[model samples]
Target: MEHCELPRRPGRLDRLRQALPRLFPFLGWWPQVNRRTFKADLWAGLTGAVIVLPQGVAFAAIAGLPPEYGLYAAMVPVVVAALFGSSFHLISGPTTTASLVIFANVSQLAAPGTAEYLHLVLALTLLAGVVKLGLGLARLGGMVNFVSHSVVTGFMAGAAILIATSQLGHFFGLALPRGGSFLETWGALLGQLSAANPWVVAVGAATLACAVVIRRINPRAPALLLAMVAGSLLSLALDGPAHGIALVGALPASLPPLSLPWFDLDTLRTLVPGAVAVAMLGLAEAVSIARAVATRSGQAIDNSQEFIGQGLANIVGSFFSAYATSGSFTRTGVNYDAGGKTPLAAVFSSGFLAAILLLVAPLTAYLPIASMAGVILLVAAGLISVPAIRHIVRTDRGEAGVLAATFLATLFVELQFAIYAGVILSLLLYLRRTSHPHFITLAPDPASPHRALVNIRRSPQAECPQLKILRLDGSIFFGAVNHIAEELHRIVAQSPEQCHILILGSGINFIDAGGCHMLFHEAGAMKLSGREIFFCSLKSEVMELLRRGGCLARIGAGNVFKDKSTAISGIVARLDPERCACCHLRVFDECRARPGGEDVE
Candidate 1:
């Protein structure tokens, strides 16, 4: 007997095809890498490193984490995101929004800058990564769509205010308590204005002034770094540590050491809510930045793969003593502008950051906390995005409501609750808008070709006395069925003498079981009243739904009209001859041929 060969299995090949690109997104760019690309990426990476140094330190202060943790965040997470993410120029690291949120949530559980706080932050990062990884594996990356642009704008503006408030004590040397409410912080600052240290205030003001002047003269001149250097030198000149000016002190110079996040059940339980909020906010920030950059590069992005990359970055980062991080818009824009040609540029940035930390971490002791405050203040100002806020407020009232509500909630409520509230309000507003569609009464206009239908209110033309025509220009989903039913009932009640009705179904794009049942019941009610209902130009999908739901059978196939001409002719033929004799305006073609008839068409 001849040996039988089993059919070749494509199972492995199919899995490979789907898994390779997702697991190693960098593989797609490998063929494009060359000597020229390397040189471009090198320069871009150099620029990115310079930009992130001061920013990382300032963001670390914002998160109430050690300055070294920020540097570590820029290392592992940056490399991991670049290797696994779908974007060519997006740079991931410590960002202001994530930092602010981390401080807000974690500060409530433990004192800022304590061992307990650090452990809690680690737990939060790990939990968030797990959540993000689960969402990516489930292919639920599209959940970001529900986070409206208005919510982000409002949340950022609110968070920016909080950032400024948090740094005020450092800016003015007032020694305000950590993690105070916005109002309490302001109140405390007000009572201690007379005790402000002039030396620290001068240093902060000088740093802010330098940053502004340099940025105005040359936008690419690393203004934050220069300003911080000037402030540090001024603090040294004044011997600031003795003069009550706080300093960041020395940061570790070695590579990030491995450590596990605390896995106590109670710790995980306490952090679960915060972790969920951070994961959503971080993913939205990453995907939005990626898509925006890809629009310029004309590159396609896989949102699910981005989610996975971010998840892995945070998960890996937690073990390296890094807190929660996300995409940095500033670094990403600089990377693209500085001629980053591939994802390799981001990898090179991480390498450059690691090398820079080795050389400069000890020197951070000279960097005064006041200067960091000034730099972060600039960052906070940038986050407000006046143009975006103004545009949202000026254009749409509903969106403005969402923005205001979110902004207020962020100011008064917990950060997690603020985010959830904003999302919920946005969805409610969207549903409210769609629940009531425009109900248009249409009449035949003789001036147009084919006697096209026009709004009765606009054209003011005589309509058929024996029939009523209406156009519903929205979906017939469950949410909208009640409103549509009431409108249809009102129209019939207004014209009881008009026993037949015609619905122009061309405007309807979708219909569900609720909508089908509504139509079936309406048809039955009409038939009982010695009247009839007809649908013209029903969409194929809507007709299929009606048929499959058995509504078409109950309503009768003869009542379903595929075209206006056939529907008009059939309805006119069935009209009482007595009523036709009483009609003054004969709009139908059949009426023109009748004895003693007047024709408008």
Candidate 2:
């Protein structure tokens, strides 16, 4: 009968089938790729390729890297992210926010755009990628939730201002120093306002005005690119170069070359904190964009898989002259809107960008820096969502405080420290909320024929004279047990005549050891005072927690009811006969019965 042979070791083919999907998640959807999808992806890819030309250069300028690095990031990272990411249409590339973070953090250690600085940036990228990959592998994608949305929003607003300030020199045709504080930059700009060059200012103003009008007129147009071209033609026509207008210069006509990130202990120690901040911010940005787009695409995103894809992008792209990269809202949105049907669109985008860079590398020499500034200013202005900010400011005072703190810190302090401050404040605010749950005194609804319970304060209805009911609306844990205990004590003090207490525990989400212990001890104390504590309508998980904590048994399992009907009948049966005889507050349907089995007229 025991003829079952031990399972044979899986063959190589079997193992490959098991592991390949995890390694390359595209396998899940690659089978669906067809001729119709290919044509759609090709069109989407072409459109994205055109748009990234201006964005890549602008993003690179923000990061203090050569424009080529931005295009390079657009290539390898885009392909890698598309190949492995769970989102069908997420297009990863250099982003303005991540670029700002790079400049803000790394500029402190080394001068921006220096060889050593580039190395450090690469190290930061590698570290962030490694951290992300580790998190993905561990399936801790939910960790991003701890970084409050308000924190990110405030940081973006502050970073937007910083981006505009950084470009002020080119925008106004002044010789402002790079990496200056926002106040210092503004002071310098004001100081040099009288010396501003008319030609450069005109180019920037024309570019900004053109981009704005084009964007308003046709939202689908490549406004930044067209505006840059217009500004370039105007600058050349006015002989702006001879008039001291700076040009972007020619770019390298090649693909991304091999590179290495610094890994020495001193470098790691110096850059670790900033790298962690970068990783957190990038993960938040990438995952949020993926989820937002996935809603429209009707595709389920595996968040951990998205993390893995982003991690791989940065890690692999670092070896290809790319700085840190992540999902771009603009590019991803364009890809989806342009009818991208699969991840192949991203791969085609990389190929097209590589081809375009090689072909048009020389034309960039005519691209004026002031025009780029105009484009960047528009991008920075885009970051300030007045509506989102207004909503946050009005809805929740605590969240508003968190937003204010993050915004101020991002403006006044080190960028990494600002992130830390915001995250810490978010956790504190969250704890403040969770630790103070609401306790509502409940009574029978006067309007309901069945006498269902309702909030006593809002409904102003009659309650049982010998018993009181309460509804708790939060978790009960060590940090909150004291608060709950005080509320329980206060309820008793105010209504001592109601000697029996019934807690409607349906709203209780969790109960920890301390909470269970406090309930047990309170039950004993209540019995000593000629009263009883009962619990009803508790969730199963909370009930299990109480049982496991030994509090349920110590408090007497008979005092806990699985449903309201049993609790009402059982609790009403224990009320004093003398109280019932004279009681006018017969609030429960069970109150119709006398203390004995007989019904009252």
What TM-score, over all chains together, does every model reach? 0.82, 0.82
Stretch of 10 with least lDDT, candidate 2: 592-601
User: Which runs in model 2 stand beyond 4 Å of their true positions?
Assistant: 1-22, 25-74, 86-128, 259-302, 323-353, 595-601
1-601: candidate 1 lDDT, tens digit per residue: 9999999778988989888866788887889999989888887787677667766877888899887788888889999888988889889999877898888889999998998899899889988888888888888877766768788778767877886887899899998975577789999999999999999999999998987898789865556667878999999999999999888766667788786888688777878988988898888778766765675688987888889889999999999988898888677766775578898888889888788678876776677888878876776676676787799989999999999998898788866566578889999998987888777988788778767878989789888888888888888989999999899889889988888898888889999999999888988888898989888889999999999988898788988899878888777787878778778777666676554465433
TM-score of 2: 0.82
Tens digit of per-residue lDDT, candidate 2, span 1-601: 6898898999999999999999999998899899989887887787678667767887898998987889899999999999989998889999876898988889998898899888888889999899888889999887666667678678667767876787788888898976677788898999999999988999999999998998789865556667878999998899988998888776677899999776789888988888787787788778766765665578987889988999999899889989999888677766775678999999999998888778976776788888878877886776666777899899999888998998898788866466568789999999999999989988888578777888878888877878888989998999999999999999899998999999999989888888889988998899899899999999999999888888888778899998877898999888898889787656677777776324444
Clash pairs for candidate 1 = none
Candidate 2's clash total is 0
Per-model C-alpha RMSD: 5.3, 5.0
Candidate 2 has an lDDT of 0.84
Error of 2 at 406 (Å): 2.5
lDDT of each: 0.83, 0.84
